[model samples]
Target chain A: MSDTSRTPTEVDDAALIERARREPEAFAEVFRRHAPEIQRYVTRRLGADPAEDVVADTFLAAFRQRERYDLSRSSARPWLYGIATNLIARHKRIEVHQLRVLERTGTDPVSDPFTERSDERLSARSVRQRLAAALASLPAGHRDALLLVAWGGLSYQEAAQALGVRIGTVRSRVNRARNKMRKELGGVDPTSSISEVHVRG
Target chain B: MDEMTQLDRLRSEIPTPELSGAAERRLLAEIATSSQPRPARRQRRRVNLGLGLASGLAAAVTMGVVITNGDSGDPGQTPTVQPYSMAAVTLQRAADNTSKQEELHPKPGQFLVFESQTMDPVDSNNENGHSRFLSRSKRTVWLPVDGSSLDGVLFMEVLPPKPYPGWPLPPEAKQEVGTRGPDRLADFDQRAEYLRTDYAYLSSLPTDTAGMRKHLYLELEPGARADYEAWDRVGSMLAEGYLPAAQRAALFRAAATIPGVETVKKSEDAAGREGVAVAMVSTEAGERQEYIFDLKTYQYLGQRTVVVDADKAEAPVGSVLTATALLKVSVADSAPVVNGG
Candidate 1:
């Protein structure tokens, strides 16, 4: 094993990208450092069937454009993500359908959908479905901003950099996405409350 | 639980993806060969020179036999997905419409609002093992446009349509969405609904169809794996993302260059909005996806897809698999937010 401290994980990503430009082989460090997380990220969106392809394409595209990489940015997360998002756009239909199904059934066909809990309210299931439908209902741009922060783990500035948009766009999109989902997260449907359900029970 | 807390709970519930030894090794090896277009010459020199310093270090890096997905067996080449193209007239009209759009720049603190709908097919087991039907939901969004602000553009919201289903949201949390499901940003975490790029980037796109087609085609080169299917990407770039009028027009015109172009006289977007459609079919996938434009102005209305040959795919022959309607895009004073939405 090589020195852990000097491993690609320890080196700055921008430097690694630069090194790969010369050695070509050095790009492996980038794949090593990020592919797992990138896979998880894509799997969540497109399911396991296509996640691997997405990851491979993302890294390959990054490799092809390695020369254009902004060496000023130390982290490759945002840039990698930007490419991934554009790619995901190709699957918007599949994605929207999956999101809606997840919302309606309270389960994801891709990842582990929801924890099985017998005691949860049926209303809660509807709430989950509603939240998903709400997300599916959103414009692509807004959904991208909201998810980047919530799932992709990027900050507002980082997301903005990744999307090539101003920071406020991210902020507003998140806000808009949340607003649509806010109504669905309530534990019970507005038409019926715990007490109303109790009345029915 | 309060809404915000519930959202927080759901966000934390996402399972860590399963790991794959093969996938990891493939990624590293793929990157190794992908560094440059031509690797034979430099690879030889670098391997020898670098071998002296790193010696076993590079070999120790886990060289493996796995092939990267990009290297071969492209799913796009599958027979079902077919050759895609768009009508030249429709492309020219879309390009013309793009050229005529009013250039927009939001003042600081302004919000960009997007209104749209999402539709998809739902199938159930109750009806003789198949109950396939499409469902539709409407949405509205408010946003803060880009510009200098004391705090920054932080506010936006998605509102249910009028005569909303009469729902009461969580009072504790300001706002929440996709608290449970496939994350919209699950890919990399950079989020922005701002599809309309600034003037500079918009101006930089190739303004001619031939040039735009060449630029996009090169993206799938090296392998030269497929045919006009790359045109699907060019058309997608025009309809799905941000592009200025001139650029959008150029893209539509470029789309005209694609082979197998077709036009549907009458079609409906998700919102049940009727319009003419310019589209392409994937013979391999037994499906067709299209971009809808107003019959007269060629204004971009929405996008749609249908199952052309149901026998090859899972759904019925005429089922609308996916549909989206972009209702409005405009500048606003502020976005819908926490207490206000």
Candidate 2:
């Protein structure tokens, strides 16, 4: 059977588990690697304090439950993501309420205008407002799944795994969320070239 | 403030703080002393802690088994006990908002009761006696039949098991209780269900005046690591009942500022504890909402959770909330006594 011999990117999750079982300190290594990314993800969603709590909760929970890990998969992002997803669920009202307030008041907890070079992007508050409003209007599940894929850049399967749902569910949630967002954005078409510029890296 | 621009601007202004040194030390120290025994190694170590995030569920499973095995027995087995401080949980409701007077006036014999049900027997007395441990997903109320004077808060603390009492737990239930340190039962995830029940049942219990200090106290089951600092803001608002009408609105405004919440309803509790029932939903799906009843006319007694969600989120398809149910009782009725120990 294939073991831990795979490429670094392809290292199976089982290998990580096998190693963690032997070395307890190996758990901290996991946190060291993922903490930054997880921090970034959480910061993007819930701001600083709550994000910190969420990150801590995520890692602590992961550390506590490390023993039952299945080693079939290579990457642990999904598992970590799954735990984070659950934590995020616990704070949905704050997130939703914050988002709704932001939508109506045009407030962004972390939005910055100075860093961006594009004048069009900078000036397009109305467009961004519509987008934020649309995003807030979508139901909780859709928003989370879509953002995980879009912002966190997790793959469909990985996103689903993180969310503790099937891959098909992730796809549909994203699709539905996207559709609703598009409708709310005054028919702003995301598929077109102009929209492409807005989303470009 | 123009919210869109403000958000964008704020995002740029603040750099996310790196993991705090104090926090890291605290967390690492917790790991060092954790009661969870490492599983025996079958192979040479091939993985590093870099893989920490992925092992959460597995860790959860293992810890659950370990803690369960380690602690399992009759909850009443332990005889030695430590002294615990009795804490109170309170919620303000709609009637309390408007009346600015008494919400409940207790008659004779009926007093407010609060309880914190535990898997570990609180003491030999409670363990062996008539104390009841409400299940993780069930909550109910038993009001006094004799029109007893119903006043004050009734809080309950029902907590998941720990490896030892009043200390760090193994990793499994740590996140549920917020940290490795000892916590009251009211702060657990299961408290959400019980909180809802407390709100519903608080209506049935009588209040003192028409609207004096109107509020319900949902005492987190003992061992809950509640966000007390944050919840305290809500408490202060409920406490200041004598404030003028315009000032009272400020209290509500203060509460609205709390993050991640939705106002669910405004009505009288079963006991006629008139108040606003606010529901705070979690951003992530399947998390339980915290329902708060800010009551009028009743003193902020304590609160308790009668029930909590017991199944996996997916097990109950299309259901955002699990099958957790809750009920609240008066503290006078539920508080445990040690039989003159």
What's the i-RMS of each model? 11.7, 11.5
Model number with the top DockQ:
1
CA lDDT of A170 in candidate 2? 97
Which portions of model 2 show Cα errors greater than 4 Å? A1-14, A110-123, A187-201, B1-24, B36-341
What TM-score would every model get versus the actual structure?
A: 0.41, 0.41
Model 2 clashes, total count: 124
Cα lDDT of model 2 overall?
0.39
Candidate 1 second chain TM: 0.54
Q: For candidate 2, lDDT tens digit of each residue in B1-341?
A: 23223224323333445655444543443343222222111000101111110111011111111112222222222112111110111223433354564334433344433221212111111111111111111111222323321211122222343332222333443333322212111111111221122222334323333222222223333221222223332432232112233334334444444434343233222122333334332222222232235444323321111111222221121111111111233324332221222
- How much DockQ does model 2 earn? 0.04
Sort candidate 1 into its docking category: incorrect
lDDT of 1 by residue, B118-231 (tens): 443322111121122333344333433442111112221222211101112222112222221111111111111121233334446688777876755653443212333454
The alpha-carbon lDDT assigned to residue B319 of candidate 2 equals 18
Candidate 2 global Cα RMSD = 18.9
lDDT per model vs. reference: 0.52, 0.39
